[model samples]
Target: MNRFWPISWQRGGLSLIIAALLVFGTVRLFTNAPEVALILGEPWEDMRQRSSAKIDPAIPGSYWGRVITSDARLRLIDLQYGFVTPRARFFTVSFDDNERVSSIRMSPQIEPLLLDDTLKVVLDLQEQWRKGGWIPIRVNYDPPFADTPEWRAQLRNVNKGGTSYWQAGNKYQVMMVVNRFKDERNPTEERYLIKLQLATPWVSQ
Candidate 1:
C-alpha cells in the first residue's frame, strides 16, 4: 500500500491540470467580461483594426432631439399677434403640419365707442347671432343721452308692457370678418396671413 501511494499522487496532479485547462477554455468561449478582455487586449485590438464601419447622417442633432425616435406629427401655428383685445379685434388662426387650417376663432374687441351708450348691445349681439333669434336693429339717438345708462328703464318697460323700446339713436349693428389660411404642403414651415374686419350698420335718428 505505501508503494502505490506515489502512483496515486502523480495521477491526481495530472487530473488537476486538465480540469484547470477545461475551465479556462470554457470561460474564454462564453464571457465578454472586460477583465478577461484586458488580459487579452492585444488580440482584441488586432481584431477591431481588421473590422470596417461607416457613419450615418440620419442621427439627430441634439440630445433632446435624439431622444425623440419617431417623426413629428403636429405643430402649433405661430400667431404673430398673441391675443386680440377690444382696441384690437381680430381672428385667431392655426394650421396643422400639412398646412391646412385646423382652427379659427373670432375675437371681437367691442370698443367703448361702439357700445358707449348701450346697456346690452354686445351681449345681445353675441346671443342673437349664436341663437339666431332676432334681426339686429340700428339706432341713433339725439343729444343729452346717458353713456351706458343702467338697465332700469329698459327692464321697467319690459315688466310693464311686455315689450321694450330701446333708445332709437343709441344702437349700432356690428359685423365681423375673418380670413383663414390657404392649404399648402408642410404648413408648419410655411408663412401665412389672416385679416379681420369689423363693419357697423348705418343708423338714422
Candidate 2:
C-alpha cells in the first residue's frame, strides 16, 4: 500500500480533476468562431453601437454599404435559413464569399399586423427592393418545411398560413421569406415574420 497517497485524498483529487476537465471541455466544445452580419436599413452609427464589428459607411448609415471582415469577402449563406427575433429598428444582413449580401433579418421589435396589412407591407417593401435594383428571380408560397413542430402541429390543429418566397436581383440576387400566421382568436386577423437573403455570388480565386 502506498502511504504517500490516502484513499480519501485520491478520490477528492480525482473528482476535482474530472470537474476541471468538464469545464475546459465544455468551453472548447461550445465556443464558435465569431462571424459578421450586415445591418440593413440601419445607419452605421446604430450598428456600430450594437456590435463590435467594424462598420463602414454604407448608404450613409441608412444601410451598411461596407463592412470590414477578416476574410474580406465572406459568404453569408448560414443566415438565409437562420431565424432571429425582430427587435430594435434595423435589419442585419449577412454576406457570402464573393462579398455579396446573403441574408437579411429584421429585429423582432416589429410587431406582427393583420394579414391584409402584412401583405400590403410586403408589397410596399418589395417595391423598395426593386428601386434598389432587385428583380424577382423566384417566387413561391408556403415553405416546403414547417416553421417548427409546434407551429406545424398548430397549423394542422388551428389554421393554415402562407410562407411566401420571393428571390430578386440585378447586380446581386436576394431571397425573401414572408411568413404569415392567422390569429387564433380572430381567424380574420393575422401576423407575419419577414426575412431576406442575398444570393451568394460565385467568386473565382
Candidate 3:
C-alpha cells in the first residue's frame, strides 16, 4: 500500500505539470494572434474629420488664428539700426493662398549715407491636396558679408542680424544686408555690416 501511494503521487505531479504547460501555451498563442482589421481604410483622415466635427465652429477661427500667430512669432525679430546710419530698413512681404507673393515693401526708419544695400526676397508655397498630407515651406537668405571669408568671420563675431519670413502653407522670405560704418569719424573703416536672413519652414508630411 505504501508503494501504491508513491506511484499515485508521482502520476498526479506529472499531470499537473502537463496541465500548466498547456495553459501557458494557450495563453501565448492568443496573445500573439493578429489584431482585428481596421474598419476605415485610411484611419488618419477619418480621425481628422471626426476631430474637426467635434470642434465648436464659433471658437475654431479664433483658436486657429492664435495658434498660427504664435507659430509666426517664433520667427519674427526686431530690426535695429546704428549711428552713421541713423535709420534702419525693414522689408516685409505677404503671400496669399494662391501662392502669390504680394505687398512687398521696404521702408527705412533712418536714412543711411549709401542706399546701395540690396534686399532679395523669395517665396515658395506648396501644399498637399490630399487629406492628412503635410507640406513644408522654407526661406533662405545670404548675407553680403558672406561673400568673403574674412568679412564673414568679422560679422559672425560682432553683429548679429538677419532677415525674417513667415510660413502658412506658403513661404515669404527676405534677405537684407548693410555694409556701412557705425561712426562718421571712421569713414575709412567698416562699421555696420548687415547680413541677409534665411528662414526655413517646417511641415509634417
lDDT of each: 0.22, 0.35, 0.24
TM-score to native of every candidate shown: 0.18, 0.37, 0.22
How big is the positional error of residue 50 in model 2, measured in Å on the Cα after superposition?
12
Q: Rank the candidates by lDDT, best first.
A: 2, 3, 1
Order of the predicted models by TM-score, top scorer first: 2, 3, 1
* TM-score of model 1 (CA atoms): 0.18
- The clash number for model 3 is 4
**Alpha-carbon lDDT of model 1:** 0.22
Best by lDDT: 2
What is candidate 3's TM-score against the reference? 0.22
- How far off is residue 107 in model 2, in Å? 5.9
lDDT of 3: 0.24
Model 1, residue pairs in steric clash: 86-109, 99-187, 140-169, 141-169
142-180, model 3: which lDDT tens digit per residue? Answer: 322223556435443435433332332333232333443
Clashes of each: 4, 20, 4
Q: What are the per-residue Cα lDDT tens digits for candidate 2 across 22-141?
A: 221111111222334333323334544454344443342132234233211122222233222212122344333333333333312134444444445455545555554444442343
